[model samples]
Target: MQSRREFLQSCLATPLLLNNFRYSDEKIITVLGEVTTSQLGPALIHEHILVDFIGADKISSNRWEHSQVISKVLPYLTEIKNRGIKTLVECTPAYIGRDVLLLEKISKQSGIHIITNTGYYGASDNKYLPPWAFRETPVQLARRWISESVNGIEGSKIRPGFIKIGVNPGPLSPMHQKLVKAAALTHLETGLTICSHTGPAIPAFEQIELLEKEGVHPGAFVWVHANSSDTNNFIKAAKMGAWISLDGISDDSLLKNAEIIHLLKTENLLNKVLISHDAGWYKPGEENGGEFRGFTTISDKLLPLLKTKGFTNADLDQLMLKNPVQMLSVRVRKT
Candidate 1:
């Protein structure tokens, strides 16, 4: 029987598999352009530069000015950059203030490689979804997203690094299921990993199952907000080849997050784990874009806690560096 590490190594090393699945290139799409995984250093797999909660109907780029948002948000990116963070996966999707041009400018100014996405967020009771999301078939939606992958989003010539979707905390709703299927279809065509804002195990497993039913591998699905699920589920999902994203790290959740990491390490599933602050954003309509959270908790708080828990520098690198390259690298993982 093959061990998990051996299985992962085989998958990553097989030249024929890489050619077939388009993994030989091993590139990560950023707002600026494609970059080799080696170019992506210690990364925060999930973070936001700006997010506007205004519904899809009313959300527009005009809601916030670029200069004002940059002035307010750049310092946070600079903070993380100074802390040795190289990449920030901006999780704010379209219709919710995902300005690729703005991300380009920020990446250039902050010297942090920024990645944007191309998917409709169906969470928040579907408030962020546009009307077409409800009316279009999954295939149609997939076509639109695949076009963005090939052609670039909103004519910006900036492609997405992954597929971002959302579902309510419960079992997948019919609409959310459509979003999952669309994400699966998009992944099959474009090789973009699916990062769903799922909070609980029920929806997380449902999304994984749905992706598998579409012939997409669980490796291509990232269970975002996996910290909200039970630890046993993290073990189960990681064993099943899903990336467990415990992205809600904060000062208050430090001990809890550290305990979870320790448990996963004991289970020998650390290779499947991803950690981040899920922090940031200059909120639109609020005074100065609201109380913006800096992206430094993992650097200043979580790493030190993990060390106290007997985590070595290698374990820390696995969580912050190696796992991110494996997770975020563009590959068509098929079952």
Candidate 2:
């Protein structure tokens, strides 16, 4: 049997064999399962279906009945679906409330495509990482993640759609470098895109350099939380072929987010930009699943604001539809 990577490359390389070149040819992995890129309309690149940061060490204690969590979150997801967001990437990473089963359930119940990720996110405080990560080499870490992408996460048949990782705010720590390098290695093996929780530009550049050193193109990387960084650095990275994800959109920050979007538009780099709320999730062990920020915020708020600021429907399509397909699609490495 041809591997999924090989199958995608074969199909993508021969567009006439299918039909159109861009949308119809590419496939993306979602939480419920896989779907063609054409099926992912008006997508959100970053959102969590559930989160358990407080119980990182004891996930069991944080665990709630799946139905209860689903009941709390499904309505919000349904509202997002009603607003026309077809796909959503669940950014929750392992050891940090990354629950694939719950995500799958949410996707099914809400009638949305949810793409879950594979990779550890121990960047902020390093507490989310398992003890073994501190001792493992980069190759070992890569191999484990590669297995998840090739096989399935935690032995479930649901494979991860992308590589999710993060580093500390400033200099890349030893562990951070290892995790980024591992994401690079896994990308090489699986052709999956790497979405790292990066910020403050310099560290994002460091990550791009590390991936480049490993022969992974910057196009395969996503600089998450990019709106928090300097505009100059954001443009620089986008020009370098990295996906600059301005994922901090909200009601209060629409104008602020619009400023960055306008900058990207002026630079003619809108093709490289992605936007989302970084919002909405059921917090385990919280009343009413803790403040569930509906995932439809971007669609409801910022998008119209962008239109008023001179983003044509075509530009909005690129940001909401086409850019995501390109960013999420598995890139065939040049041979």
- Per-model TM-score versus the true fold: 0.92, 0.91
Among the numbered candidates, top lDDT falls to 1
Off by over 4 Å in 2: 1-21, 332-335
Each candidate's lDDT (Cα)?
A: 0.89, 0.82
Mind giving the per-residue lDDT tens digits that candidate 2 earns over 125-213? 78888887889998999999989887888878889999999888898988899999889889999889999998787889999998999
Off by over 4 Å in 1: 1-24
- Among all windows of ten consecutive residues in candidate 2, which has the lowest summed lDDT? 12-21
Question: Largest TM-score belongs to which candidate?
Answer: 1
Q: Which pairs clash inside model 1?
A: none
Over the full model, what C-alpha lDDT does candidate 2 score relative to the true structure? 0.82
